[model samples]
Target: MHFQYCPHCGKKAERKQIGDEGLIPYCTQCEVPLWDMFTTSIIAAVVNECGEIALLRQNYVSQTNHVCVAGIMKLGESAEETVIREVGEELGLKVKSVEFVKSYPYEKKEMLMLGFRAVAEKADFVLSGEVDAAEWVKLEDAPGLLREGSIAWQLVRAVKVIFDDHTLCSQFLRDYVDLPYMKGIRPEDIEDVSEQYVTLFAEERNSDRVKRVHVGGGSAPFFLVSLIEHKTAPDYNVCMQVFRYMVYIWETYEKEAESIQKGMAKREDFLYPPILPIIYYEGAKSWNVPRDFRSRIREGSIFEKYLPNFEYYLVPLRDYSNEMLMEKKDEISLVMMINKLQTAEDIVNFRQLPGKEIEEILKDSPEHLVNIIANVLRAFLLKMNVPVPETERLTDKVREKKMGELFENMEKMDIQAERRNTALEEQRADEANVRANEAEKQAAEERNRAEKEKKRADIAEENSIKLLVELCQDLGASMDAAMQSLRDKKDMTMEEAQKKVEIYWKEPTDIPEKKNSPNG
Candidate 1:
């Protein structure tokens, strides 16, 4: 509430500078600054055993969009109390359990909305007089029924993703194995034995441990235990916590060997599995502390031999940008990218155009994985308290694939990429054909030029022979002169020279005829 007059003394307030608060309404009589006050409320996504949400239709809030059960906080009541009371009063159903989700600030209503996921057994909802109607909406259908950016939608989405730790862990491992840090850890090598260890560690810890066995060729299988912890805030004791968990896992293995392996626990041949501890931090603050357990101990160098030394792989989501995550082209990278969203614009932009990585995933990844990615995106957008068209589009993209349209899209993309490759090959072939044709044309031109030169040489030789014969006849020379000239100038043999002289010499006519008669 904004105070124009001091409530204590009913004196008119004046604007006064207060330290770091800047200008504030100050009353001279009370010597106090009046600050704006807002109400607090609780918003809950009531879920049942069948994984359906109880969405209520309230005309006052929104006629078209549905809302979750929400109510103003009462005096001397905690936020959890408000959730239970509101659910009981509004829906007349007992909340089996309640989990606190993220808080949302409703600026328009001047209220802070604390979101919760309240699970209840499926039963008929007893709607209050204020509610027009209430229906059980499937988890997948909640986003469509509620307003896109409303608190109700956001809460429902959060609840949908909260229980999906197994899927999340599997996806993380699949992507994590590809990183260079986990050297030689291939996807095929990861064998999840989580079920075997779940019962052993359930009493001591709640977080599930993903135990994978790496079976090498003709060798004993090695056990790799992965402990993944996600922190939204910095925890300095994380190293100690990881160390304790690692010890517990080893202890569990030892006990299992003792009970199941017939006295192998006490044997020297017994071995403990290697544990890989990883911390995934998405907090706004930087995690600048040391990751090694030895670093957490004071002056551990002196006692290094006696002390344990193990380091955790820290995956700080803030250290990577959206561009960096997009390069990974995996589901976990997409999750990290969504976690890095700082504004509604960023969320909307990503939803609208998720980049090439998403296309790669769509084209190559399995259908269930695509569906999981779509749900992850929807959950992220809803948790961010803003809705973009991309969430619905992505969800529909997955559903369309299930209905065969999505696979068609993938096939279309594959065909387009293949066509581009084929077109390049055809272009190369056409270029080669053009070069071959040019070479053939040049060769034909060269052959024709050689033929023309040969024909010219033949004509010149014929003209020279005719001129020589006429000259011999004019000079009154005999056929012997012509023969001698053929032998000397043409470099012909005696027989060849005689033949040439007889054929070309028109016999120096009458003069050659008299010389033969005289000789006879």
Candidate 2:
């Protein structure tokens, strides 16, 4: 949601240069950026086993022509779930299987519409109140009922091709291969003789096989195998896995030929299809695993001529930056951008992406894709602890385009956060000062106690000295005796003892606290 004021602190946002995103409306207080928001919905071309499509007459959408079963996606429901729920609610038919066709971006309504090819059992029309009428039309004639080149038409056409194996295979080859032979190949010229090889690792592998008819001067049509392996992490056995799958495909083709009693499996003239191996890695970690099947073999270089060598093409998502991804401006890139966000901070800061950049990313995207992306982003934000009300404010701010006010608001929030931080710091400093003052007062009290103890010791020494001299004089002993007593009792040097005796003998009457002495 584009923010004029920071939703967190209710302050105006500020335009600040944040990383590679350039200038963004940064909430200085909460330090969060506003994210883009959109509504998501689904439309489905409902088909039955009887080669007929269930079309609806909704006056709200189109009065004259019929429309597919469509409805807005509800919160907490996946796109597929929404399709199934809508089909059941609007046309009273339970969906058997749903195959995704493509997304349509309805920018006019600011919603994304995901198109699907839903298969349901043929039944009588049990219409909902919203639908005026519902009827089953043959698959071949279904497109003519809807407006040409419209979203519904395209979806039906795609479904028709998908149901017809020959047409779908030929269309896939034409779009995938760059060879000149593909130009002359028609839908009827292709055969759906694909013998898929499934393994325990099939969960990680998406393999497709199609046989193309020989055009102009060729002898017969040959099978073309394309293997697309999806990897979420680096694996050393990936080469072995590809090699095993390729071997299985070749073995299957050989057995089929041998069973038919036509082309000999071991014959030199026997033709085999080209096998293209591709590895699509979307892991966050670096892909450091060996790229070639030969790399897995010991001493592969020495036996290079005998050993098979082939490398898979790697498409790493981590190689693309946000700018580069936005430049691509496709559904894949949009999804990748969402995947690139890892941490909580990264998730929260996604809203800080520039509005112009978002517009450019979704510029030519289908109408349904906008809503899909919006739904995905909304889910991500909600899971990341973003508030519900803030998520609803997503409008194309790039069209309204207010940076100064946004920036000003964000700056004010930043100022408020800074002020709070400053206040907290000052309070801590004041507490520290109080602690220091208490310590100084304690030190002063200790010094006073020490001084009083020293004074008492001095007064006791004076009284003792005077008593020693008086005792010596009364006992008729010489000054030497007093000095000897002082030296023996006080452990003083001869000189110190003599000096003490002389001072006490001369000041015997001036002695302080004379009665307090032991021998007074």
Give the top-scoring candidate (TM-score).
1
Angstrom error at residue 76, model 1? 2.3
lDDT of 1 at 199: 35
Displacement of the residue 264 alpha carbon in candidate 1, Å: 25
lDDT of 1 by residue, 315-335 (tens): 778787666777766656765
Model 1 spans > 4 angstroms off? 48-50, 157-165, 168-278, 282-289, 292-371, 379-391, 402-520
TM-score of each: 0.49, 0.36
| Cα lDDT computed for each candidate against the true fold | 0.68, 0.64
RMSD of each: 36.4, 27.2
| Model 2 lDDT-worst window of ten | 403-412
